[model samples]
Target: MKNTIFTITLILVGLIATSCSSDSSDNNLNTAESLQAVTDLALSGTWVISSFIESGTDETDDFTGYVFTFNSDGSLVADNGTMTVSGTWSVTSDDSSDDDDDYDSDDDIDFNIFFAAPPTFEELTEDWDIVSRSASRIELIDISGGNGGTDTLTFEKN
Candidate 1:
């Protein structure tokens, strides 16, 4: 009877540990807001795209020489000397979909970006999950629900 009880307890502990473990996809989920109280303030000022990957392709060249300004008032600007694009950006934890919060949307915090003009710049638009962040660098990733493709974006303060 003593051996049986000890085995049962060990099994229970194993189960609890397994359930608590998070996979790679969930590693950075919902970290955007929790790490910083004022996300807008943290993201304010100018940034440049250090790296951008789209569908297994290196597309960072598309944004080369461009400077992005994330305004506190939800405004975004990208100027590459000759051309300038305007858009909006935000950091939010609202993961609700059309079917509401239960629509298989994890509680992942998102660094949302939106640019309307210039086809190349439009591709930067996505609700990217914050993978890592620091005073000078912010890394983001997004697994496309429609295509299952993984895209990554990195920004460095300039």
Candidate 2:
């Protein structure tokens, strides 16, 4: 009788542990899905640069006149005068949302940047820290270290 009771207790403990593990995995998946949904909604539209502030500088370059087109197929094209640049972009990772209750605002909308420059059209990509995102606007921090200054670009849907 003692042997039978011990076996039953062990089996019950194993089942409970497995159940808890499965619940955690499900929670992770749901969180990921929620973040992806926001990204997909933000990607497919015409976004005009509402503001561009270069990091470390008090001067803010107003780009309210230009439009940035990001197609659903991951292509990018921007025209701000006679100059036009074409490139491609892909989401490297969906970090988390910018909810005041959950994650820090600074860590919100974090993702990567992929681009193909002119002449060769070779693909070049880098990680960009996204500052904030919504159905109508996206703010990204330029993480590329070069002559290009770090900038915060705010875009609005057109």
Candidate 3:
């Protein structure tokens, strides 16, 4: 009777442990379709720069009066009534690279921006990690590989 009870207890413990365990793969299984959903959300509306921090300094004023639009074609435009700047943007996921990158995870997603000219707008160009997002707001961050500085950018619906 004692041996049978011990065997049952061991089997129950094994079952409980298996039930409580989590699948790590599920956390790193970011798919392209989900990334497209995020891009679609950005394309849904226009936004304005609510905050910009570069190496602990706030620089949000640099984008004053500018409204940004992320189009479906990957074209990004910033208009400030008086002037307009054309750029490109993309939201991409790179699991393989993130495996070794300290700043990212296996399911890391990056928001990339590129502007050819205008030094002020050029400052926004980088592969920023998506911190959080909603219909009204989106937050991004980047840690410079060269300078070890942290930069943050936030966009809010305009």
The backbone clash count of each candidate, in order, is 1, 0, 0
Estimate, for each residue in 1-158, the C-alpha lDDT of model 3 and write its tens digit.
99999999999999877765644444444456558767987898999999999999999999999999999899999999999999999988866554224545314677889998799999999988777788898888888878889999999999
What TM-score does structure 1 among the candidates reach? 0.69
Which one wins on TM-score? 3
How do all the candidates rank in terms of TM-score, highest first?
3, 1, 2
Candidate 1: RMSD to truth: 6.8
Q: How much is 35 displaced in model 1, in angstroms?
A: 7.3
Candidates in order: C-alpha RMSD to true structure = 6.8, 6.9, 4.1
The lDDT ranking, best first, is 3, 1, 2
Instruction: Itemize residue pairs with steric clashes in candidate 2.
Output: none
The C-alpha local distance difference test score for the whole of candidate 2 amounts to: 0.58
Per-residue alpha-carbon lDDT of candidate 1 for residues 26-116, written as tens digits (9 for 90 to 100): 5454445363443654466689999999999999999999999988788899999998899998877654543222222324566789999
> On residues 40-118, what C-alpha lDDT tens digit does candidate 2 reach at each position?
8557677776665555553324344556676667677766677666776655434443322222243333444455655
